[model samples]
Target: MPHRSELYEDIPSVCWPIVYSPDYNITFMGLEKLHPFDAGKWGKVINFLKEEKLIGDDLIVQAREATDEDLLVVHTRRYLNKLKAGKLAVDRGWAINVGGGFHHCSSDKGGGFCAYADITLAIKFLFERVPGVSKATIIDLDAHQGNGHERDFMDDQKVYIMDVYNRYIYPGDGFAKRAIKRKVELEWGTEDTEYLQKVHTHVEGALNELKPDIIVYNAGTDILDGDPLGGLAISPQGIVKRDEVVFKAARSRRIPILMVTSGGYQKRTARIIADSILNLHNLGLIDKELVASEAENSKVEKMIRDSVTDLTNLSL
Candidate 1:
């Protein structure tokens, strides 16, 4: 049968930073509130894509608000109850901010930064609704580990998680795990070349091992050189190249991906992430936007391969 587009079909390009801040309110994660960081940054990106004529009016910008049931997929009933009670402000593990952040959320509870639903909700939504979409692999490249996702899918064999996080930090729980934890930890003050090498290595591994039907990409921009929360110092060009690498890999493998922007505390986050996503759209990895021409596509292919080789050989 020929492929058909679903929710992402009508909308050639949609940006999701529409959910109100209260939906992600967390008081214990030490980080500030959600603010307009996601939306504001995403808006800049979409506008650029539109100006570049990469997207059309048919694109649907769905505001993803997580329901209680969505949260229940990987969380426990007791923890769910705490969240509903609004008393999650006290416990570090259940605290909304901690779990809300997207980095530290575990299966039943939350950690360092993850508070509520981010990739988990998207994955569940896609899995339950989309046909022939059973298995998934979460590609998380935030400066911090995707501890929440790793723990959530630890025993489920249905989900494969490949994370590239810093070697040391808060909520240190990624190493020495029983599952397929492709944890690539860069030394503090790591540079961009070293970062991309690890991303390429593990991403290649994920393609071979899990053989996922879909990919949930946590396109975090915090790994950039001057990010407020991240430890690495990747150049802006390096970050854009990284996204191209990820998107190309998915496309070559014939995998469909649902991208959810995760981390990136730089003041210029919106611009950076927007550019990266545009690059992804340009490469035809995401169906929401127009694909590049043969010549442009060839350039992207070379850039990704060359950058990956450079990254792999860096001394770090």
Candidate 2:
């Protein structure tokens, strides 16, 4: 039997697949300010969405922290037992986990502020619990290499990874790079035009190479210009367009996708993330109304099929 999890519970039809929680924000007496990454940016992203009337609390799916069992699905037992710390809100079509993108952590190790490998866990949970989800694709567009998941799935052919990051950044792991089937290395200050072109070409190329059961998009805003860590120079509009390209590719192929907000360092990054989400909505990529309409259509089709079956039985 497949594993049952609260994280994969059925949500109300009215709610969007965007996942978030108050606990996602880390606060330890202003100590988070010491780090370059904005720890509170997750909450700020939610606030921006609310202020723009894009989403209300009730209309969004609340994120659940990953339990030990859930973590063990992809992580080692020793890793789960050692720290005991964790934490997706998407249905079959598409979902985005606003808080998770711990691509720097692995089963037995943690780094770059990532304690647990949530990306790996999410994919594993789907494969174990959700039927017909045996293959997965990881599209890591963060400023730094996603060494965590790359290491974990290094030997697993069921998972295909395509990583595009600044080559000069942190965790220059040669072993991890071996896992990336399609690797696009960027130089410092790579701007929107060149950056977006590569993202578009490579994303399409990767999908064409292999159509996976789902696409896991590690959408990091750290590639924004002036980011101290990311080292690239993608513009705000470029980020939004980049998301559109990936989501469009998945939607076109009718593949289920889950996006995670990964590594964004600046305070304005929150607003940009929110804006990108809104752009996706405007493009009809993540609209709640569209999902509801599809559900109603499915219900109607089932009812009609039942009616036809009843008439046939009566004739017999």
Candidate 3:
């Protein structure tokens, strides 16, 4: 028998496919401010969504910290993905874990502030537990190379990885590049026009090549024009458009997608992330299924309650 874990709990139907928690914000006595990456950005994204009235507190799925056993599930193999986010995606058709896209962390090592191989773990979990989910595709659009997962899934033919990152940045793992089925390395200060065009072509091509069961979209905002480490010239609107393109491809193909906010160094990264999600909703790419499912379940629940009330009144 497989070990049961708290990270795999069923969420309420009324909740949106977005998964987050306040604990994901790590503030070590305001050191997060000094740090290049904004550790507290996850909460800021949630706040932005709340201000827009796009999502409610009750409609958000809370994420719990993984225990030792849960960590072991990720460790049993090479590298691991976020198990909770993976489970949520399998059930909801699409899910976004606002805080998890630890692409630089493998099972045994850590780099670029990434401590866990959530992307790899998620893919592995789905293949093991979810039926009809034998294959996975990782569309890693982070600013830096996702060497961690590339190293982990190097030999796995079932997982197809397409990584688009700045070729000049951190962890240029020559060994890891062997895993990327489709690698699109970008130059410093690459802008949106060429970036978006290439993204569309490669995404379309990757899916057409081998349709996978799940799409793990590593949507990193560090590609913003002024990001210090990202070294890309993409605007806020461009980031939003990029997300839309990936989501559209997944939805059109009816492939379940799991998105994770990977790397963004600026303070405004949270706002842009929220804006991208809102754009996705505006495009009708997400949230419809959850709303319809909740309505149907609510009707059934009310009928059960009414029947019980009628029985009690008759007994009286």
Q: Report the number of the highest-TM-score candidate.
A: 2
TM-score of each: 0.69, 0.90, 0.87
**Regions more than 4 Å wrong, model 2:** 88-92, 292-316
Residue 148 of model 1: what lDDT? 70
Q: Per-residue lDDT of 57-144 in model 1, one digit per residue for the tens?
A: 3432323333455455556777777664211111000000111236466656765545554455445544554455578787877777
**What's every prediction's RMSD, in angstroms?**
10.7, 8.3, 9.1
Off by over 4 Å in 3: 76-91, 288-316
> lDDT (0-100) at residue 280 of candidate 1?
56
What is the C-alpha local distance difference test score of candidate 1?
0.53
Estimate every model's Cα lDDT from 0 to 1: 0.53, 0.78, 0.77
**Residue-pair clashes per candidate, as listed?**
20, 1, 7
Task: Give one digit per residue, the lDDT tens place, for model 2 in 177-233.
Answer: 999999999999999999999999999999999999778899999999999999999
Model 3 lDDT tens row, 177-289: 99999999999999999999999999999999999877889999999999999999999999999999999998787676778888999999999999999999988888846
What is the alpha-carbon lDDT for the whole of candidate 2? 0.78
The superposed Cα distance between candidate 3 and the true structure at residue 72, in angstroms, equals 1.5
Query: How many angstroms is residue 40 displaced in model 2 relative to the true structure, after the best TM-score fit?
Result: 0.8
